[model samples]
Target: MSAQAQMRAGQGASAQAEGKAASKANPIVSALHQMAVSVLSEQLREMFEKADDILFDSAEKARASDEQRLYLDTMRIVRVQRNKIVQAFQEALQAALAGIGEDEAENAAGRLDDMSQWSLEDGDVLEERIAVNNMQAKASSLYAHELVELQRRIARLAEMTGAGLSPESMSPQRIIHAFQNSMRDLPVDFPIKLVIYKLFDRVVVGRLSEVFVGANQLLAVHGIEPSLDAPTPARPESRRAPRGLPQDSGVPSWAGKLDRATMGAFGAPATGGAGMSAMGAGAVPGGLAARQAGHLAPVGGAGTYTDSMLAQDVAQILGSYEHGRRPQAPAWLPPENVALVARMFDAYYRDPRLPDNLKPVLARLQLPMLKAAVADPRFFHDPNHAARRTLNDLFEMLLQFGSAEAAPSPQMVGELQGLIDAMVQAFNLDPATLRESARPEGVDERTAEAFLREQEEMQQKKNRARVERVRRIVAHEIRRRIGERPLPSGVLRLMLSGFGPLLCLDYIRSGVNGASWTETMRLVDRVLDSLRPDAGRHAEERAAEEAELVAAISRRLAAIGFSEERLKEVLSGLLQAYLELVEAGAGRTGAPAADTVDEAATAAAPLPPEKELQGLLSILLVPGSWFTLWEPVAQTKHWVRVKGYYPVQNTVMFGHYMEERFLQLRATALATALVDGSAAPIDPSPELQSAIARIGELSFERVVDPVVWTTVEGRPGQ
Candidate 1:
């Protein structure tokens, strides 16, 4: 062969070798790359097909000639360019995957430059840029849960493979960029492009859960941990010095017998004949194995591990807390039980969720709880134990009435103080007194339950009345605004059926003078003005104004709980109405028919069964369910109780036990908060039960490395 031919062959051989090496280096990345390309290609094809149907359906339903023509033209262009779009998207996705580990700074800079270029370009480019951002935000909110799970799995894979990967590597931005880039050369206007983008969002982004699942499964097959365990902070070093039993302590003969029985129960060989010497010399095994052997069984069928012989010991510890003194765990208590209680309370004290004022209140319970745990063998093992139940109820009540940012009301402070004081005073050897003091006003369980139910019903009635008042205010404002200027029938319907409820939400959240109310009122004026023809303005300027009005109105209507599909329909009708008024060269001909305004106000179109059911489900806030309320301004979470659901306004009213005013959230906004992790439902299980489980987990960790607890003796209030 000639030298030139040999050079060409060598170059080809080098490229093939590099490909093999790259594939061998990270099989996981290669698998993921292939998976993404295949899924996106199929999704793109399906998205176009769905877009065709959506456009056809929209065109058929369009009320005005102009609106129908726009849909038909967009559909035709999409159909003709479908193959090229899919191929472009496939190439873009492949390129994005290949660039996963590249420097993110350069990519971000490149994006910034591109955005600058778009701003300097014509109006269409700017419109496309805004559309992309809006689509990304909507998709992210819609698929937040799936995206989070996918991100966790990807991170695990990256950790195992020593590869750099992130959620951004496979974000919807890539899909959107690729699709937008493909359409950059198309002849469609911004409105048509926007319709296509929405369809793409609905079809492609909606099916992202499948793509995420596929990627997760592939990573799982590659030995990556599929389940993500939340990272726990390292246990802090103990501050308290370890205390051992005193050698010269007074000890009765019966105590010696009890010590021997306890050691025997733990499988420790009792030696030196039942005395302090036997207890000190015989090392008690401290773990699950020792517990399984019934180490805490009552000595000689007595009611508690420590008999009346240790009553004075328990009293000394309890009195320390009552008198504002530092308390220590009794030496007579088993080390394992002491360690468990200490660790549990330590965890509680360190928890950021617990309010500061309540910390001292909870601290007072430490000694009493430790005493109860020592007396009851089943304290840690049984979740339904009476003492555990009482503790759980008390902890929950404290959380309900307390706020990290807000001061507790005087009534709240008094009630909680009284309950804690009663429980501390009444708690003796028997745990029954703890249960009695946990009830309201020290009443019996049945009477307490009845009283609480009645209080809750009254709160619900108050919430409903408040919501009705807000609704009336909103309805009156909307009526007055529309009556100020003559509006087309369609505009009147949109105001009543779509915008009215959202105004109510705004008024409820922030009063009539608030920013949300002001912005919504501005949107209402824009909608009214857009329907009138502008004789002097250029066609392009008028079109741009109309586009802005539609986008603003779409966002406002979305706040009233319209689904994406329903929103498209509403916008279509709105656009058609605008076109008819413009074509007739009439501006504010007359007020809408009185019957039309009244009917629109009173009768909204019935929601589809599925939509109605979803709305209902979103408002199903069971009373007493605790939610972490996100205050964006304060950047803090406050515990709030689900007071009641008001179906008339589709709102959930949240109450702070210390605050008389309730915080009402529309169901849509609440659902969005939950999806974005701003609001999270706390575990409804008993707090004490959860703490015990954590203690068991900590114990297991200690068992694996016994030295972890060598210096950490149980210090009750430390």
Candidate 2:
């Protein structure tokens, strides 16, 4: 009937023999078990000391009087329970290594080599080191949690006694008395003494920072057995360090309090009201302390709210961070706004049209949205609020622009800009203020907006116009190849539109040698075959085509270090757009809607030449490439002649030479000149050359011939 009899009965002769063998074979497991037992026993002792007499009537008095028969019986039962727990751990350890190979066991156990001496060159060794550190951290955390619980109990006991057990005012005698009375179950080692001092240190700086004191003295004398000394008076103002303010000295006198200072910071009290719990009834405002000290039931509470309701509110406030979803609301987010924003973010996150690359941008909007909601809840709270609708539109517009390879059309940009300006004006908000609130460091709103515009202009030069130039050259080559046959203009245009941006990107990423018409056409043919009308019906077929296009473009993108998942998605979207155009031209339009054409059923329409040019300009402006000026050399005789040249490094690829293999011009220079349509350069000087680096061949032939020239006499006509 006794615990010892039961423990002995549970472990049969065979089981006891196996446990003994396991403990001896795995000394590491035995040591770990010993450590766990020591910690658990101390924790049990603290729990017994903290629990009110109502919970276990004899706990306090029984433990103190070991001479009593009742106390001896309790010890025997505790010892039996402890042995059972240790034996269970030993059995678990043995089971874990039951099927492990000798080498793996040796590696896991740190038996082959002392882990501290293992070189970190091998990934396996590094991982083992990390695993060891993680285990140590877990052990330390467990120890710290128990210590925190003990400190909380001590504070509660002090409040009950009305003696106010302030760590700051406690003498060596009091510290030793508390340790002997409360922690006698723990092994009296330097490690346990240090941890006790660490607990006092955490209380001094944590939520209880304003209440508990004397960490500096305790830390100074930690790890040494205490000698009885007279208790000091209440703490001095100068001796108490305020929370958040650093000590004047680089290191606080209590700096050596804990090995894990960061962990201790979190252990601070969560509320400023915690100090009231440790104070006397007179110290508490009104009867707040008395209420908190007693069973924490409301004085007039009945059935106002149920436990389930409170739980639901807590869950809603916590957001979905635990479920592995992103855009989680901050812990400080108000409960009312939590569900609304969570639902809104969920919808945006799930939209298939939203690219993966723009998710981060969408997430960043969460904080700004929270701030705005706080500023004006009515604008954000209503599902159909105009401001909310405008914000959604803004996010979509940004996603579209950020996702595209080329810049958006000038008209489109103007429209969005107007919308943005209108939204701010209509809401009576300041653009500068909003920008300052949301913008991260080093990212100026004006600078980013300017960069986007520059992209539009740059794209205009290199994109459509330059692509057209390549198309014309390709067209000429095709015409020559099939002498009298009519040109396959439809197929050629399809190829050019679908693959042009990729080829241009390739040319820019590497040199012109990296991409050629011969190679580009080869990939284009594959795309064309996969995108045939019949193949479009098959999801797998379309996916294959998308994969091929992405693979081709990604190779060059990788070279330029622009290998983003969203880039592939954008290319796939473009392919779909082009295929829809070709399919529409083949008269494959489905039924029309009563009010408007179904978006999927409608044919894709080409943009007007001006619009397309604007779009092209937008695409060309981006992160890389330097805008430069190349002045034409002049020769004067009877007439003045200005010989223009594109000075380019052989290594650089220009947009105009997308189809050209042997030579590549700088897209920035050619694009700038084409946009201006002027022979006059920005004027290259030593300072400018050093800034932009103009070290290349003066390839005059690469530049387009001039339509107008200046005469020696400064006349317009020659």
Candidate 3:
């Protein structure tokens, strides 16, 4: 029964057992087995490192934690490695079967059904090799599980570390307050909460889907990452106190010392007077970090409280934008937040710096990105204002700033438009109106054809001369009202272009975020206050409202602190209001709101409009009918703006902007009229003739000649 004799005779069970015993007894074999196990673990770790890069975001701080990282890496590698070994073994087995004689192959595979470890003797040494492979695979799996457990330990340590984390300073009491406040603010039956509950309930039924598991797991994993960075000491300050701050003891074994620069900024953070476990006993003010397990325990079941409907709507809008929809247009989007986003973008692009305090919050919100896109000079500098040309333009471009999940996913404009359409639907609007409104923009061939056909019908009733006579009468009537000067004519166009946004306010409110329309109207009223020719009442009403908004801004701005610069900022904001209201006004009919007439929204702040505007408009009881935004040339930023929505370009879209456009139309015609004796010829050369012709035609085309407007005498000539 010597082992060597048994191996030489190895053909039966007794010989096989003897061979196993010899293999165990031999030092050389034992050393080789140990070497193989080490090799397997190292390979698994390497595989995991690659997978981690693909699976999760790279963390600057987390990379240093070798123990935690290595374990996770190994586990990932183990799974891949195990799967690879199985595939190879299966392929080898199949190939072997194919190579065997036909009858032998059939018999061999059949034998596999009843195969045991002992069956290796029947198959020869290949079967024994496969058995060894199985054992190694099992060992790797066990090792991977151990790594998972170790990673869990690191996560626990992260929470225990007393190195207080957050975007701002907070005491333990503050933390409690913040959580309570956040929880209390949560909607009583928020859809997200319900979804979380549903997920939890489904877990018991074993129906939890992979997506549910994945999103929830992602939220849970973030618990270990710091929400905020602790303030670090300045290099100069920390140089003196080289050994100032100590590492928090409860932190993972990998968390060593705070860098020299970070050591002396602030004292260690205390939680409930908890001693520092992150440091050592009696080493810091805080005894230990707050136990985070209590905080992280599923607040509301699985915490999948997100609304699928909202998400779907958002996703659709986002997708539409991705497919080419814009949501960032200043006028088209019309959200105050969108305006703020635009302004923020301009400032951010100009400054290209962010305050440290805001960075953490910025990380959570994707607003910064929209601003960035707006600031991207290469794309945004087009004189055509093409970037946010439409709502779809803004929406589609919004995705560029963040990952898919973090992108701004607005709800569909059409879905919101449904609310606008609700009226047309409910009232059973006429098909003609629908057809008119639904046509494509810029070039409507069908409309042109229809117009041409109608013209032909008119022509059938009368000759070209008769049509010409009617056109002259129409032009004359418009000229009589719009006046006969170019300056006033341009003013008319500017005035009329401003009113559409104010009127569209109602239409916009029908969309999903339109509940804010009331607030917007209030802002608009502040802009419109100075334009009214007279004031009967509601003057006090307007003043009170503007005051309230000012007070609110003051209180909020106070927290950010005040300075001479701050005063100027507030005053400039008011000046913008004045420009939007009194300074921008063109032509007005009714009495202005008394309170808003006297003051801009921030006029009370230091450096009031009177000082800056030289009290020019201040003395005028007129607040005036014509607020000249620009003289000679329409450089809005360079010239002072007069009251009204009429920019140097357009105003009629706001309120009575079209009335001005009408006046400008008339004025343009009159200005071109002959002062018979002054010029060499009444008519200029073809080039000048073409320019004037185009202008006259455009003005005539734009004029409002509704018969009723004619009845209001001096409507344009005035």
* Residue range 1-718, candidate 1, lDDT tens digits: 7785565346435534543454456655665666677777888788877877898999999999999999998888888888877875665555555552135323533564474676566676667666776666555544433454456666776676576555455665665665665565556677888788877877886666556555544444334543344221111112222224332222211121111211222122422211111123323222211332232223253543332233333333322322223335434454334334443444343332345545656655554565577666556655545555455546655544542234544544554565566555434343233223322111233432343233222222222333444454556566656543445566666776567756765665456778988999988777755665556777678878888888887766553435456567656656766566454444346554332222223232444433442333332355655566566765654555676766567567675432233566665465556545466544322221222232233211111100011111322210
Per-residue lDDT tens digits for candidate 3, residues 190-289, read 3222222222222211211121222112222222321222222111211121234343332211112111221122223531211111121123222111
Clashes of each: 0, 18, 77
TM-score of each: 0.31, 0.20, 0.17
The Cα local distance difference test for each model comes to 0.50, 0.34, 0.27
- Candidates ranked by TM-score: 1, 2, 3
Alpha-carbon runs more than 4 Å astray in model 3: 1-512, 530-546, 552-568, 571-718
Runs with alpha carbons beyond 4 Å of true place in candidate 1: 1-24, 100-121, 226-718
What's model 1's lDDT at 343?
37
Tell me the spans in candidate 2 whose CA falls farther than 4 Å from its real position. Answer: 1-126, 129-336, 339-368, 371-386, 389-486, 489-718
lDDT of 3 at 495: 22
Worst 10 residues of 3 by lDDT: 674-683
lDDT of 2 by residue, 515-550 (tens): 454576566555434433352365565567666675
